[model samples]
Target: MQVRSLVSFLALAARLMLLGGLLLGGLAALAEDRPWLTAEERAWIAQQRVLRVASTPSYGPFTFVDAEGRLRGLSVDYVSRLNELSGLRLEFVAPEPFARNMEALRAGELDLLMSLRETPERAEFMGFTRPYVSVPVVLLRRVGSERQALMPGEPVSVGQGFAAADFLRQRYPDNPQQVETDDKSMLRRLASGEIDAAVMDLASATFQIRGEGIGNLRVQGDVGYAYELGIGYRRELALLGRILDKTLARIDAAERQAMVDRWISLQAERSPWQRRLLLAAAAALALVLLGLGLVLLWNRALQRQVVARTEQLRIELAERQRLQAADHARALAEAANQAKTEFMSQASHELRTPLNAVLGFAQLLGGDAQHPLDALQRERVGHIDAAARHLLILIEDMMTLSRIESGSLAVTPLPLQAGPLLRRCVELARPAAASAGIELRLDEAPLPLAQADPVRLEQVLHNLLSNAIKYNRPGGWVQVRAWAEPARGLLIQVADNGLGLSAEQLAQLFQPFNRLGRSEQQGTGIGLVISKQLMERMGGQIRVESQAGQGSRFILELQTS
Candidate 1:
């Protein structure tokens, strides 16, 4: 009674101690916003956020450096939103001119830069943000400047204007022009009858002419396509880049549309003919007919090509069907062979189990215990058990190989703690390691939950460890390690100091009955083959890295859940 009371007291004390520890742990966790990250995570973040950003002024009302030099713009707001979602901080720095901004980005003084026209040359060093705004480029003019415009029937000057420049360069090729300065100056020049009208971005002209108090300016007929703006980042922050991509996709579509409307609606007066540019049916009908003829001819040629491709596809499909039939036949043959092999293997193990028991009793019953033993009789009985044990091992290997190859092997995946799995594998292979006079060591860290079929994963680990031990030299060592790579997933490797494999042997390592050791070693060599198949079934893989005399390491990769 006294001993029972003492034990009860100890148990109560232990429960109270556990409860106290749990309370402390919970409080600590609740205090942290992002406690999931460790010191290593801080290092990773440092390596990733390696750049300051630069931007141009008046590029849009969206992006500009204010007098105090803090960044503010449409591009700025979008990037700020991006940072909020990604949890990665960036330094936004704006120095000066667009050319200087680009120079800073190229020289690595900044991590990213924004609000510049995209060119093939820029794509070489940077990645672009998702296009958030597309605006038309145009030149607004008063009602009287059409006939007096210089270069009227000459060629358009492009290379400097935005969308209109791009369109005229491609569409009319006859006339193009741009004002290097502000549209108001061009408007003054036009009001005073110097040049015809100013070529500027459509939004700029609208803001200059009406929103900012200049008069007598209105958009010409529909200018062209949209001049889309996108942010630019360096090429190396791929994960962060991908995160931004997903975040951008999640932003409300209406919100993006509102931003466009808010910025552009603050700025334009529609020209009278803007709504009627395509309203002339007689003129448009003639152009439509010409376009239709070309479209029909191109469509007719496309149909011919499609028909030829369809026929080629038909022939290729027939060839594929033939190959499929051949593959099916081969699969059936393999299944049948595997069935036979498994039956023989299991039968041998079962049959020899009883035979071994019988042979043991017979030898004991016929021994020199009761009377003088006949050496020949004892020897015969010993031979029966000796042969049976050897046969049993071979049978076991063949059964494993057969079931695995036939795809009848079951694989059940769960999130497993990595450290315990390695320990278990080492424990299972301990006897073999002892027999070889080799040391088996496991190097493990706190790893993530591995998505794996525990039984099959353990089987592969055990087989590798067993092989390592079985083929190793005396006093040799076998090491097993588990590591996690955020990018590459999980790695579990088993290495050995042993008689290593040749290139030819390595190539055939995962083939059934392929033994790398001499005839002296005890392996049917189906373990690796079975291991490979089972690993694949679980969406894991096994690969061997080896040198002829130095030894071999077999790496197993698993997805971390």
Candidate 2:
């Protein structure tokens, strides 16, 4: 009886252990699926067990309802994937018009929105995930419409709740906009000549025209705005936003591409004649493949001869590579000579204006006794002085740039105090800043010593300060700050609320003599180039951050001493 009891106890223990193992495995699988989700996020998800998601009903290819009254599109597929990956209950609300859906989202009647661009107005009430898809906004017009281009006075229809409507209102305000219910209505109006042109995303426009059999409309041109679509949720549901973003990220590139291909495929309806043509084409392709196979078999027979010829060609290839290297060196030399010639031409042109002013003013000054000096003559003398100083500065910048390019410029890095150097630079620029009605502020906090060439660093700082002052708007401010980074480096930033640069301008920022379309500004344009080289020589680096019409910041990083 005791032996029997022992066997039963062993069986019970084994079953308990098995049950515990299964429980642990289930928990491990859950963690693996949602590694980024924090305990707080999981708790929040538990509380909000169901998320009501909606998309525009007429935005085809992205999100739309089919004739069978089912939500189907790329966005629907994305939501389905999100649901599967996140293990969240995403219930779809009934399909509604775009404006009503937006209102529903705003009224807290909906929990999530799919495939919509996040505009500033929407951002006030909702938060957005990173864009998963981007499509260009295109203008559509009827085929052979008299409207060649979107005119200022022409009426352009855009979807009422679409981001393109807000974009058009802001960017092309002169063009009168008629807000339609959706892309379908807008396109229909465009086809019937009620609207001159309509703005919508490429996917929706193409889908509507082909699916609706509206053959009269054609894509006119891009509207310079793209719809970067993403999921948007209520602003207060910050945890939900994180959950959505993490889940979206879990959907890999291949899966996202598959979803896009499933929805955005363009297919042409083939008539009987076209079907016959396709059959003939398929037969021809089969014949071509057979010929290719025969050719491969023939090539196999001559493999040995081909190998010998390949070896000979390899020897010729090596010779060609050597000659190519020589040619590349010659090309570089010619480029350098061309650069020098262009520099000289620009320098001479720059020098002539100031030199002419100086000479002309000096000649007037020399004859001042005959004219008897007046207030205007005195002011002219000051102009002469200013012209001469500008000429001297231009010459110095040119010489410094030449020395840098020739590798003759010396940079001696040594321990130096950053605070005093920054303050001195700001003080030197204060007068210019004041004259330009710009406020210059320097951070007075203690800063660590940095390893940099003092003279070269000062030169770079002066150039940056001058630019901040010169290009600043009236009543703008320039802020200078220096701080020690955790990486044992000192970062000095000269930021200005001035006329900022575009991406194209920033690309050519370091190129010598590229004024970046600011020809009206007084600059030799080589100061930044010289500064970049000088910083590199001193074991440092310089970089800029800018957005057009916003502002610019120039940062210099040096090793902490």
Candidate 3:
């Protein structure tokens, strides 16, 4: 009996010692005069009478109202701790909805809001505290969903004013969304099967499923983004934000973690049977790992053997494929060449027969001395002849394009007099310019001989001259200039004072059949294309420059001898 009394007395002494130490520690903490606060901050807090803080208790664990209708949650707990530590009086107002809270904060009815996302639009009226918490956004689906990913067409639900709503809209704008007033409403809709999916922060989803026991919904995956929560205050209260930041920085990591643990337990409680199943699964995994080691060693040796055999087969298969591919490519080339040759032959015959007839009859009538045709009759014949000649030129241009595409167009360059040839082209185009009431001006300086195919050079010059006259206004001017560059080569430019091209039109200027909105003009659309190709084949370059209201300039660069 004496030994038992001694043991009880020892236990009682231990309890008394622990209680005394805790009391002393509490008293010491309370005795701190200006702990973790600077003198300026203390003075500011003294002058600042009472800060009206507005918060919503609808968001559990973060902020929420209790049964007594008091604002209490993670944010509330922090407010209380901060007030006690700093000797600042913060008055908590009635619980308000999130939208109302923002409105009140903006209207100066409340000094600050507890926690909200910082967005660019909100920055216009309010300043934000440093991020205190980050909540990952998650994709929640029905429990038995087999989908590997969220489709853009699926119906989704998101909190109306959540930052995740903007993220979702950018990610899947085409998807239909049902915007709920809050996260709870979103989850309720998801549980009722009204929406296929809902995007919300992981913290709220966990509280709904684990804390509230809403078991029908499950988190499929994260939305790959997160919201950073912070204190929001009016822009006028910038100094207050700085003070809050300084105070929050003073809170130690251990105390902050303790506060978090006091509010949330992420891991849900498991039943006894479920705990046993988890243990059995762990044991099964351990046994499987043991057998897997032996199988891996055996598989490594067998894989080496199979790889050696596969090398020989792979080489043989590659050689056979290479030979077959070569033969198939050769056959395709032959077929394409034969088809092109046939097409060109048929096109040439079919187009020239009617053109030959029109040219033949018109020439005969225009030149006939027995009929002695009048001036008007002669002019009519001239129109027919010009039309027929234009048709013949179109056919030739098409044939040239085909040859150029097939790599069959040959360029035989010879020394040619640049000055005389350019002069002749200007002279030939003068009649067309005069008919169109456009002034054709030639500025020809003595230029060195150019190394180019004479026929192709003539074609390029004629097309540029004709296009200048055709697209010019009634009284515009076309200037033809030829000059020799010291080291670059000879340059020919055709500038027109007519409607110019835009940057977009200039980009596609040489594309085949791109008429540049001049479909009413009488010519094949491939003239510029043929011109560009002909210049390239003869080892020359062609380029153009134009502005919207000003006219266009086509520059052709040729090699000089």
Best by TM-score: 2
The regions of model 3 sitting more than 4 angstroms off are: 1-32, 35-39, 272-561
- lDDT of model 3, residue 479: 98
Clashes (backbone N, CA, C under 3 Å), per candidate, total 9, 0, 2
Q: List the global CA lDDT of all models.
A: 0.64, 0.79, 0.78
Residue 416's lDDT in candidate 1: 60
Candidates arranged by TM-score, highest first: 2, 3, 1
Q: On residues 1-561, what C-alpha lDDT tens digit does candidate 3 reach at each position?
A: 999999999999999999978865654444357654555565566556689888775777788776777766788888998787666677788877777777788788998876578887787799877555556677889889876357858878887666777778776788788878877777777788877888887667777666556887876655546666778888898667767765664564457667767775556578999999999999999999989998999999888765356688899999999999999999999778756754663466357657978999999998898887899999999999999998898887876776566443444454566776688789999999999999999998987877776657888999999988998899999999989887779999999988889999998898888887877888888999989988988889999999976889999999987
Order of candidates by lDDT, top first? 2, 3, 1
Off by over 4 Å in 2: 1-32, 265-279, 291-561
Task: Report how far residue 3 has shifted in candidate 1, in Å.
Answer: 90
Candidate 1 structure quality by residue, lDDT tens digits, 1-561: 999999999999999999978865664444333343344443344345435777655444655455676666566776677666444566666445555666677777777665445555676787665444545455445675553222445432222323345556564565645534333455666555565555565555554455346665555433323455556777675444444544554455466665555555532455778657656766789899999999999999888765357688899999999999999999999767755754553454346446556656766756657675578876776777667666666666665664454333335454566676688778878887887799988888878877776556777787788788877899999999989999757899899879888898887777767666567876777778878888887788888899887899999988887
Better of 1 and 2 by TM-score: 2
lDDT of 2 by residue, 272-390 (tens): 99999999999999999999999999998878565357688899999999999999999999778646743653454346445756766676785678677778877787777776777
Count of backbone collisions within predicted model 2: 0
The global Cα lDDT (0 to 1) of model 2 is 0.79
